[model samples]
Target: MAFDWSVEQIAAAPSITPPTLHKHYFRERKPRAEVRFRVEAKLFTVLMTETEARNVSTIDKYVKHFERHDACVPKSA
Candidate 1:
């Protein structure tokens, strides 16, 4: 994944593991500007075994629900 290298780089710089780096910066446990950038830039990855995948899935589900709702609602003229 594209973020793997970035994560590794970040981890190396901080002397931490990639997963820990992800937990602190990439996970949606807290709202962060960098997280939003990752989402917008498609720089994040979802691993099936990790909690990040579940978090990402939750965000995706909400986004899809809003998209459906927007499609069903009429726009104001």
Candidate 2:
């Protein structure tokens, strides 16, 4: 699923800021699998990537994201 919302609305909804720093809401009943990594810096950052369970092999689903980030971008299909 794809979601696009404004920061203004997210901030007002719920969070941990003066007005509350709420960003997004994607409450899945159960996540099929997950992959997490850490970025070392002044402060460590955790990146959690996930996908839901499906009967067939969704290679395309995973393939598209290979271009989603600069680090994961592929040269050719």
Candidate 3:
């Protein structure tokens, strides 16, 4: 989903100042699944790189931890 709200649109909303909007809700929200997928893709790339470079041992713990995280984090509605 996309908000597609411009700064002017946000600031023009009832009782909302640009500074207030920025300080409180500047960043757009993303779904948990999207975030997880991006993270998994990046991690997979790094894992493959490390394996090819013979440095997989260095990130073994991280791979295990990320696997656990993937198993535990639920998809957002």
- Give per-model TM-scores: 0.29, 0.21, 0.51
Local accuracy of candidate 3 as per-residue lDDT tens digits, 43-71: 78888888889896757976788667657
lDDT tens string, model 2, 1-77?
11122445444445434233422334421222221121112112111122233313344444444336435434451
Off by over 4 Å in 2: 1-18, 22-57, 71-77
Q: Candidate 2, TM-score vs. the true structure?
A: 0.21
- Candidate 1 runs further than 4 Å off: 1-54
Score each candidate by Cα lDDT: 0.54, 0.32, 0.65
Worst 10 residues of 1 by lDDT: 42-51
The model with the greater lDDT, 2 or 3, is: 3
Residues 1-77, candidate 1, lDDT per residue (tens digit)? 22223457767876999888777866543343454456545422333333554676756665676467557655751
RMSD of each: 13.9, 12.4, 9.3
As for candidate 2, its clashing pairs are none
